[model samples]
Target chain A: MILHHLYILGITVEAITGALKAGTKKMDVFGVIIIACATAIGGGNIRDVLLGNHPISWVGHPEYIVITTCAALITILLSPFMKYFHRVFLVLDALGLVTFTIIGVRMTLALGHGFIVASIMGVITGVSGGVIRDVLCRDIPLVFQKEVYAGVSIVSAWLFLILHAQGLPEISVILITLGTGFSLRLLAIYYNLEVPKFNYTQMD
Target chain B: MILHHLYILGITVEAITGALKAGTKKMDVFGVIIIACATAIGGGNIRDVLLGNHPISWVGHPEYIVITTCAALITILLSPFMKYFHRVFLVLDALGLVTFTIIGVRMTLALGHGFIVASIMGVITGVSGGVIRDVLCRDIPLVFQKEVYAGVSIVSAWLFLILHAQGLPEISVILITLGTGFSLRLLAIYYNLEVPKFNYTQMD
Candidate 1:
């Protein structure tokens, strides 16, 4: 139940971020709403589609579309003051990332997938929305280019699996995974941590 | 059954195109294969996903992946001679587009969807692989920017629907759709037809 609410929060924050990106490209309102919704739900949609799961999350719950659309409109209205909330947005986004990862891991595991698939699904759920948004906005995906974003998701997923294997209470697993993932993401940002680059420009 | 064979040809041509694009970006062999598979099957994968269809095509028939992978590898070896085959590739690509569109429409109608959804799925299956390819290559989608690509898919889909509605035999509908779609695409190229651009740069 708590996970469900956090999922909503995650999508809302993601939508705002997507709307901001679309604004950078000066997309019309329709484009903004589309991008916002894609960033909000695209990850889970991709995950479930690849996993052969039916009735993708947004399809089953149209309310999520409403939430993302509202979030996009609100972001547009508040764009002038967005700089002031940059840090706050980042924190919220971090929270959303971990929440998404946890949910992805749980969902995949519930489907009887093994750890590898669950971890991949978790990372997919956590970052692929941003990937989709960046692709639509014509930017190289940030997840592929910078930061510990996917790394945080992988760690969170593994931690959840290990903790659950130890027969820990579900709530403890959730809280601990969320706290750890969130803190790790924040610390990475604070220290400007990044995965090493793989620059290949030679003719191949 | 003939559609099944055309589907294979479509993916092969699409894979070669994707591999060539990856080569331009100096992507490694693995990247080439990934792009190839994506270009070959990504459109149908996306359509089925959005439509809530299960066991996405490539998942159910993993041989498609193998076919695309081989196509990518062969493309790399044949890159030096690719210029000589430019026109041939375009013709094959046109065939692929119509084949994919027909398959998309039939699949959606089989699932009990209306013309609108079927048409949309047809376009998605016909062109979205290119969109996904361009996005991964970090270029704005060609379908959204230039040419009569998506429009051709839309026409083919609608044509299939209309002819089928006339109580035509399945084979006749498929042939007519393919021939018209293919001819129209070639004519668009010959005439240099293009959709009007949407250039919005004003600050809002």
Candidate 2:
């Protein structure tokens, strides 16, 4: 029940983030809605497709689409107010990252995938919406270079797998994994932590 | 039989294009392979996901992954030689566009989707891989701005639907779509044609 609420909040926050980015690009309303929906659910969709999960969650549940669309429209209207809420935005984004990773891991495990695959799936699910949003807006995927992003997902997912494997109850697993991942992400953001950049120099 | 070979060639060409981009980014072998495979088949994967088509083509036919990997490897080795073959590259790329569009249209039709959806699917299948490749390489997706790219796919797909609606043989439909798309793409490239640019101005 908590995870469901967190997931809903995460999708709403992510949709607003997408709309803000679209705003910078001066996209029309349709573009804003599309990017918003993609940013909200692109990760889950990618995870589902990777695991051959059918019907795609949102396609089967249209309400999620409505929620993200409304989020986008509301975000566009409140664009000026967003700049004052950087801390709130960061906190919500961290929560989203952990929640998405947990959901992705759970889905893959339910489908009988191995730990390694599930971990990767978790990372994909956590980061792919941002990737899609950035790519659609013609920006570099933040997961590939941003501060402790995909790293956080991979680590959290692995932690979940290990904890679950050690006979932890499902509720404890979710709560612990969520706490660990969320705290880690917030710390990374506070410290401005980053993975090492892979800038390649031309040899010839 | 002929279409199969054309499909192979088209994939190989697209893979090489992806590799060429990866080379510019000075990526390692793993990055090259990922981009190559993504460039070769990401479109179809996107279409399949959008349509709820399960298993994915590459998951079902793994040889595609191998082909793209090999193409990337070979491309890296032949980087210098590729420069001398600009015309050849254009021809092959044009071929790839048409082939991908036809395959997308054909797949959607097989799934019993309407002509409009099929046309969109065809456009997605024809252009998505390149979009992915561009995004991964931190370049603007050419399909979003390039001359007649997605338009050619949509047009060809619509043409196929019309021909099929008129009771033309499947083979004839394929040939006509392929020919029409290829020529249109070639002409667009030669003339440096472009869709109207949608440069947005920030209001606030």
Alpha-carbon TM-score of each model against the true structure: 0.62, 0.61
Instruction: Please list the residue runs of candidate 2 whose C-alpha ends up more than 4 Å from where it truly belongs after superposition.
Output: A202-204, B1-53, B57-131, B140-204
What CAPRI-style quality would you assign to candidate 1? incorrect
lDDT of 1 at A134: 90
lDDT of the candidates, in the order given: 0.87, 0.84
Which regions in candidate 1 have their CA more than 4 angstroms from the true location?
A: A195-204, B1-45, B52-130, B142-204
> Which window of 10 residues has the lowest lDDT sum in candidate 2 chain A?
A195-204
| CAPRI band for model 2 | incorrect
A9-91: candidate 1 lDDT, tens digit per residue:
99999999888887777665545666788899999988988887876786556678789989998888778777678888889
